[model samples]
Target: MRWWWQPRKQHGRIGRQVTALVVTTAVLLAGTWVGASRIPTRWFGPAHPASAQAALPVDRVVWAWAGAVTTTSATVVAEAVRPARRARLVLTADQAGVARSTAAVPVGGDGIVRLRATGLRPDTAYRYVVEVDAIADHARGDGRFRTMPSGPASFTVAVGSCARTGSSGAVFDAIRAVEPLLYVSAGDLHYGNPARDDVTVFGDLYRQTLTSPAQAALYRSVPVAYVWDDHDYGPNDADAAAPTRPAARAAYSAYVPHYPQPEPGGAVYQAFTIGRVRFVLTDNRSERTGTSLLGARQLAWLQRELVTAARGHAVVVWVNPDPWIAAPAGGADDWGGYPQERRVLADTIAAARIDNLVMISGDAHMVALDDGSHSGYSGAGYPGFPVLQAGALDRPGSVKGGPYSHGTFPGGGQFGTITITDSATSRVGVELTGRTWRSTILVSYRTTFPAPSTPPKPGTG
Candidate 1:
């Protein structure tokens, strides 16, 4: 009987076909069983390897360009050993764990981690840590940063924008050579899109830009704050109506978690006081819709903040991703898009008699210094507040030239730095720093008062 069961040669062609069919069915069954059982185990097993640690020494430290005090945020591109594993971010005031706190989410593309530590004491030293996995492998490390002084203090703040991968890091080295107290990235941190599909690319680009040894060392030591222009947000000169808005928002949500920012949907805009100066940070990208320069609610909030600052001896600094005082209109990406609204803001400031107001912006990719003369406000129609437009750190050259030009320095690779000294004299001095491959330079400084000595009070003026 066993010999008969193994005897396949005795059968004809039909018998051979039947045998082949049986063999094929058996092979299929075996494959199905193995695949079903093995796949689940591999996916659910606890024995899998852990993810790798994120690359150390994150880059792009942007201090609050548009906020109250000198509050700031920093961003880093890190990776996990396993694709499914998540990275851990932490901020601390001291190494003793007494002042440790997690930072708020930042605003940018995905795969980027941000750690923001706020309510920091001015001019004080604080230690921080950026950990990968606290609960699992417990991977950890530390870094250090110092806050701006609460009173008259002399400290350098390195400011720039428009940096891309593959470029010489000499500019960053130049900025770090100054050993600035804080680092500010005005906007356009990266050129890659902030959409979902481009997140990995964005991360890669950011990683490449930060890989420089000089940039890493400075970031490890200094606190960074940032805002986003169109490129970093997605698309060149992108607006609120871009098709990738949702994807951009998701990326922004993911990237912002590594930084300290206010709650989402609740105005990323905020204000903080550092020394005698008040910094006002704005979210010109998120929650900004319509054809107007600023939505009604944000405008109202800005007016309120400005009014409050006018009553005190603090220097109120306003930062936006786009330049408001720069020339020839037609570009919906800036304040020029909404002339009515800009007029409203200018008139309000004039009516409130608010002094000590300074406006700084990026996104023009050129170093421009304007005093609001080209902003379309007549000398008699608006307050003569000094508005400064610092060119971009990446492309420090002008694109379109016109009659409203201030000083266009293209390919100059420049940024602006301001130094404030609060003394009994009640006058604030601001210095603008510009840099190039040749040397780091201090371009200019202007001194002004919160309230003019001979000016009438608000209600009586």
Candidate 2:
């Protein structure tokens, strides 16, 4: 999606309905718009096929995304063109056959599988291999992911949003190279949204984006958490009032692996804690209204979670799909449009003195780094936290004009990383880094938060 300001003229509208045909045409025709080289080499031909060494009885099993992670459990999602009654997920502490197996449940008729693995050790490293059938085929030869720590620990996370199916996806490689424990995709995983919101269209769109080599490799290795944006949700600028909201929500549920959703029969907006970090991912499109981005129930849930996380976790990561800082001119589709709600959130954080909040967002097709000062509140009213915007993973565009805070870098296949390092003492170091397609650091910011003092030892005096 383009920036809110200068929408029609300067940036051109985000394609209303981004079908495979439209995406191919746009990438081929506008070679100069985003840059011809940015398009994935495989898009000109069929989507990347499985490697020659892939196992038999399956053409290819595409690894989708991973999430619903806890101290002892996590889910892996995948899809295949070949039909299979059951899928196998094997987790091994090492390569020497100390393995645990889990069964996968098939969702819908599209051959999508969700393998929910449990009984995992907390704060441990494990190598995993996903096999479509017990004896037949395996999607990934071997992949590795670390379970979330049960207690205070150090970890890195990659965050980004808005990727079309055809982009070269260099950022995905960069993210994998960083070896983040988790990667949060704020929204817009794919661009194809038919006007009627057909399930077939949704499945096709997902395959086009998820099966690519870069994305598949990333998901195979790193766990992912997702939230939806406008295009992926339905249409351009679509909202909760859309006629096809139910269908869209169902399609998302069928394909994407996520934590238990808070809003039943609506979009997925949920919270999960991994070690010292508490993640609150918001549903921006489904419940959005003129006054609030998140509906009343969701908003209340968020406020309560913020307080709970602030009191306990070393850092609270608030994931919103739209840019929270350096808002554009007219606030139609972003947090800026709903000033009262934004004010309430900011006021609550400030009044509570929640010092360890870091907001990560995507949608603007640019990377923006802000200290929360530009959120339009002043005079100690809004004690702003840091908001990092990692935009347009592969879509065409650069950083546009706005009241960018300390660091704002032009975007083109870029993502953001947040590394939290906990210590024995009462201090936690948090680092935020933004990088480009070729792994160049665009902006890096670091801050330390003093952890709450330990309780006095009982009866010491």
Candidate 3:
């Protein structure tokens, strides 16, 4: 609501800055600049001390994550603890030639703070800190994030989902070790009591997930792009009608550094780009109905995205949190239950003539991949495509959709890595691998997508 300039004093070399910076705060609202945007502001108050904020025991809330990142803009978010008037972001270049910044901005409320920066270089790493007033909050470890790469590039994105509430498994360390450009949490972020609707309850779950030593460290380093599934949204197999969905979404908007959604205060489905690959994350739970998967609004948006995908990007990653192909028997909770809409979606893809689409899904425990085979379910008999099923981050593995050409592994502590190489003269190749908690490869699949003949825009879409 309040948009006014607040002067900041520089603390490091300007040109060498990993990038520029912006910030905002929330007592539960988002503001301008994911150059850090909105963070949840759940203010818990005890009587104020006669002296100052330095001595207050504000340990109830802790943790920070940066996301909604771009070549020139990035957002950092942290939950509100006690009230504070101002907050700022401090960014340090990764190496000698990188850029660093100490852009300061006004904080709107006491408990939460968010800041975003613009004019940052693409694909550069920078360490960050969130300072309240002038003192640094220890919520962010030696945390760092890289802006999405610009132009033809090579990067690795780590993807996983399904962690028990407050799990701090070593798998997180494995994810951080890979140092992927970004981390994608496909769905089921936490298995808390979904029946609870209180915003604070969900907020507390986020706090626990973020503070767990290893997971916190991973998030501190890699920016995350996430969506929710059955367990995290409500009771297992919950649909759009779950009463607690609004509160769940509210917690998500407040806590996660995320992308722009198709609709405000609705499903968290969104799209973003890294190099030439476009990632389309879907909201399956909140929009689910007896006959629809993404709801009417999201389905239309998806059509437009696919229609334009082949013309612009080299690869399209459709992140449907549920299985895309044949769901297992008795699995009516997923696409299997909605045959008509599934046919329509498949038909749409066929009509678009897009062969660059690759699906990444979670919920089914095992990590599996099919190379453009067993992927077509359209009426025209659109024969083939690719699908990467990843997850069970810490849950028991169960196979749901497949007959995958690649073998599937059913076990706990699993994740997937997508290695993308987009070059100027050759085909853009994507390599998908299923791995374990200790980083062992379970199975692998490789596929090729048409690369732009001529150099395309740096960041498509």
1 versus 3: better lDDT goes to? 3
Residue-wise C-alpha lDDT for candidate 2, range 230-310, written one tens digit per residue: 888888877888665777788778788788887555768988877667788999988887667888988888898898778
Off by over 4 Å in 3: 1-61, 96-110, 138-141, 327-331, 454-460
**What's the TM-score of each model vs. the native?**
0.67, 0.83, 0.83
Pick by TM-score: 1 or 2, better one: 2
Ranking of predictions according to TM-score: 3, 2, 1
Superior candidate under lDDT, 1 versus 2: 2
Candidate 2 — what's its lDDT? Answer: 0.69
Estimate, for each residue in 324-442, the C-alpha lDDT of model 1 and write its tens digit. 76343665667766666777777778777776787767776545554545554533476455555555444424433222324444433356666665563546566554455335452
RMSD from true fold, candidate 2: 7.5
The global C-alpha lDDT for each of the candidates, from Candidate 1 onward, is 0.50, 0.69, 0.73
Ranking by lDDT, best first? Answer: 3, 2, 1
Compose the digit string of candidate 3's lDDT tens values, residues 108-215.
453555677677778878778777767776555246888878777889999998877766666677788788999999998888756867777777778777766667
Local error of candidate 3 at residue 196 (angstroms): 3.4
